[model samples]
Target chain A: MKRFAFFPGCLIPARYPAMEFAIRQVLPRLGIEIVDLEGSSCCPDPIYFKSKDKLSWLAVAARNLSLAEDLGLDVVTNCSGCTATLSEAIHLLEDDILKKKVNDRLGRIGREYKGTTRVRHIATVVRDEVGYERVRESVVRPLEGLKVAIHYGCHLLKPSKIMQVDNPDNPQVMERLVEALGATAIRHRNWYLCCGKACQTEDIPMNMMHDLLTTVKAAETDILGMICPTCFSQFDYGQMKISKKFDEVFDIPPVYYFQLLAFAQGIPYEKLGFDSQRFKPECLLRF
Target chain B: MPEDADRDEPVRVNFRFRRELAQKIEGNLASFCYQCGACVGDCPATTYSSGFNPREIMLKVLYGLEDELLGSESVLWQCTNCYNCHERCPQEVKPVEVIISLKNMLAARGIYPEVVSKIIGTFETTGRTVRITSAIDRQRAKFGLPPLPPVPMDEVRILLEPDTGTDEEE
Candidate 1:
């Protein structure tokens, strides 16, 4: 089994423990071992903390990277935001000057960044490391008739040069993954839009979420498949608020792609944490 | 010539300040922005709120209207940090990075969204953005998950300290 240090970030551990359960249940069966990233802090939230203090942001992200560096393994995160922040920090710290500055802060804590560790989102790990054919072969049960709309959350794809996860404009990797599990991945309008988690404080996030959900509803997909925990929260929990606000019932369930994978891998549905979801994925039970 | 003319024309641009802000950005990507509106067309925030245009933020940065951009309640937070602007920019303007730099400047003065302040405060204390309530712990245990590992909060505090020689605290 290929061992990796798991970086679960803040949300999955604190807010969405079910998602973590899904990841833990699924990855090991696929021959991947997850080692807990002990002593890790928040990705410090790239957008919020980076805007507040870039140096502090770098320090925190570097600190998290060092955990995996100490393990002599690359870090893999389930949250796309964590992957983005950590990857961006690695890119920034590549410069000797920036590395020295961040390292100087880290030195206070008796930690040093050797600049050796790399970060990967779980999607990239499954895509590149576990070949598609292997995923197809591993499937115990296929989601033959289910139609899934993949939400490739923003940070997973963009700032294209830095992320390098997939083609930014025409991304089919997630859709392709959906297909590998024997589901029809539908291409929907505004599927490329951000889940609007960052814009939640203001009215715009709701407006944006409403737009994306409307398009998904119009497409008539059974569920929205995504990788990031933040997107999962916004689409899964936020759906109720959006439905109430807009006075339209959007019963579409938002599910992590991994949860679906575990289900398709024939992991018991009860262990996958389907009971905790706000909008229970009853539609998926049919398969 | 006329009284209306004096009132109608806005004050002259602060060329020096504009150049200073532009220089502060690494690689001078801000100066590279030629305003083709590629970022505007692709920006999700712009599609929702007409007031949240990124190209306009770039234009404001170019014009040295720091107060206008930073003082505005909506624009900066509206950006989901999607990076479509950076990806599609023909000149590699990287409008998102410029906006982040501006936010950094504002945050140095202790100016930013209240939500950001609240979240960062929690992170500084607990080494996690959200506290691990008893209920959450119960849920983790119920799922056959191990207890959360401890965080080195003391080390986190030291790392979060304002680096010496920077008056960010003041």
Candidate 2:
């Protein structure tokens, strides 16, 4: 079994322990050993923190990367935002000039970035490291006949050169993972757009979520699958907010891909955090 | 036109686009953009708000319109950092990186969105953007997971603040 230092970032532990629960339960079964990353700060949020302070962003990320490097394990994260921040930092710091500048900052903390480690999102880790065939063999409850529409959170797939996860335009990694669980992965209109979580300003995130949920509801999707916790919260919870704001009913349960995977692998229902889910995932129990 | 002369201040294109912005992002990918408008065509932000266009921003960057770019209030924030434009751009100019560089410039001047400041402040203090609530703690305990490890705040502060030694050298 391959081992990794799990970087859950700020969201999962703070907002959604259920994602952590699902990840912990599922990754081990797939033959990937997960270790806790102590003393890690936020991926510090790529769009917000990087926008506000570039030097601090690089230094913070380099520190986290070095933590995993010290452990001699590559980093694996469930949050797409963390994946984006750390991976982009790693890619950016490759430049000798920027590396020197960030290292100058790191020197104050007495740490250095050797850039030896690699960062992978949990979904990518599962698909690449565990292999989809092994995932298929492990599924006890094939999510047969369930139609899942994937929100491939922008961070996981974009700036294709840096992320290198899949074809950015025609992404099939999440769909393949969904299929391995015996669900039919369906495509929706707004599948590729940002969850608008980055636009933390006024009505934009709500407006964007409204558009995405409306489109997915129209497409007759059973569940919205996401690899990012922020996207999970946005759609899973944002739909309710959007419904109240627009005065329309939207009852789509947004399930994190790992939660769905754990469920399909028959890791009990209660552990999946279904009750806390805004749209109760009781429907999936029928399968 | 002559009657409105008092209302229109002289168009000052004095602000040159910082070549440093281009260098910071992908090492000169911004200069390779030939203004194909592919990024504009794929941009969702541009679709919703017609005022925000990635192609136009790139043109401004190419033309050294730093004043024009920074003067665009909330226009830079309109980009969701989706990277759709980055993916679609044939020239591989990751416009999102340039957008961020612009935001960093504005942030350095204390001119970013209020929400960004609030979130960053939360990170600076708490090490996480979201505060740990009793409800979150209860949830973790119920799930049988150990409490979250204490944030390395001393190290976080050192990283967030400018290095004193570097400043002294400067």
The candidate maximizing DockQ is: 1
Question: How does residue A178 of candidate 2 score in lDDT?
Answer: 97
Q: For candidate 1, what is the DockQ?
A: 0.63
Kept native contacts, as fractions per model, are: 0.71, 0.72
Candidate 2 lDDT for residue A65:
92
TM-score of each: 0.93, 0.92
lDDT of 1 at B51: 78
Q: Can you list the residue pairs that collide in candidate 1?
A: none
lDDT per residue (tens digit) for residues B1-170 in model 1:
12233776876665755654543324146778887899998888888887789888877777667667667464677787888898999998888888877777677667777888888788777888778778888889887877677688888888888778843333
> lDDT by residue for model 2 over A147-171, one digit each (tens)?
9988898889888899988988798
Query: Which candidate leads the pack in TM-score?
Result: 1
What are the RMSDs of all candidates, in order? 2.9, 3.3
Q: What digit string (tens of lDDT, one per residue) describes model 1 on residues A161-230?
A: 8887999889878988999999999989988989888763567789888999999999998888888888
- Residue A133 CA error for candidate 2 (Å)? 1.7
